[model samples]
Target: MKNQVSTIYKQAERFAEITKTAIITGNISRAKKCLALAEQLLITGSNETKIAISNVYLFSVSSFMELRHCSISNLFPKSLKAEYIKQINTSGV
Candidate 1:
């Protein structure tokens, strides 16, 4: 379990590095690594952690989309919205 957690942390660090490179180089593919990593972490996490992570993800996505002038629906679907609401209600996230 410790190894697994460390592996996840390392993967997240790599994603952050890629994201930084993307920002510096203006590469869309590299930029997406951060979001991909975030989704992966939440997907493999415990229910409580997923709820907490999804809260942060939702906030970041919302903020970024608004900054880019894109609609939230462009990425977040009805299912994700429902899940987020349910998690928030149950976990107080």
Candidate 2:
């Protein structure tokens, strides 16, 4: 179980990096897809992994917003935003 969780956490981190890169390159569709994959991994991840992925997601989005001078409300897909919110609420982070 520990090894499995570790693998999931690492996969989530890679996806998070991909998401960030997609955002930086103005690839909204790719970013959304990567974010969705990360969220799916989060479902099976442990608490620590969930928190780490959440932080990465938050950081990526915030950095993108700052770089683009855009509003957070306009950044992510509605479903992604909803899933992020749900993750935060459920994870108590």
Candidate 3:
């Protein structure tokens, strides 16, 4: 069981990294989907996994805030604003 939990967390971390990359590249849908998968894995793990999930969400929220307020126009798309909100609202991570 411990090994299985560890593996799940490992997978979650990998997925989180991928999600972060998608966010950086302005792929909101992909990022949101990946993040949802990560959260699912974390949800099935122990309490520590929940804490790790919180950190992941914090990182994502901070990244979104930075991208949304970026001075350059292309860094963040106006159309993504609604999607971002939807993602955050649904993200229990």
Candidate 4:
């Protein structure tokens, strides 16, 4: 179980990086696809993994917010935004 979670977490990280690159390259569709995949993987993760991934997402959101002057909620779907908020609150992050 532990190894599986770790593997899933790593794959999600890779997808997140891909999403970042896609966004940097102005590939909005690709970025959205990768982001969705990353979110799906995150949903299946353990609570600890969810918290870790939330941190990553928070960092990405902050970077994008700084660059684009956009709201954090605009970066995620409604469900994902809620989940991330829950993780952040539960983790005290």
Q: Return the TM-score for each candidate structure.
A: 0.45, 0.53, 0.44, 0.57
Which candidate, 1 or 3, has the higher TM-score? 1
User: What ranges in model 1 sit over 4 Å off?
Assistant: 1-25, 71-93
Stretches of candidate 4 off by over 4 Å are 1-14, 70-75, 83-93
lDDT values for all models: 0.53, 0.63, 0.54, 0.62
Q: Candidate 1 at 74: error in angstroms?
A: 6.8
Say which candidate scores most in TM-score.
4
Q: Residues 14-59, candidate 3, lDDT per residue (tens digit)?
A: 5556766787798877866765654564457577765555555434
> Model 4: which ten-residue window has the lowest total lDDT?
3-12
Clashes of each: 0, 0, 0, 0
Which digits, one per residue and each the tens of the lDDT, describe model 2 over residues 1-93?
Answer: 654534544655566667778877888888767766665645766787666666665555555666778655565555456665665577676
| Pairs in clash, predicted candidate 4 | none
* Candidate 1 lDDT, 4-53, residue by residue in tens: 53443354444445554564576656555555555665777777546554
Q: For model 1, what is the alpha-carbon lDDT of residue 20?
A: 49
lDDT of 4 at 49: 64
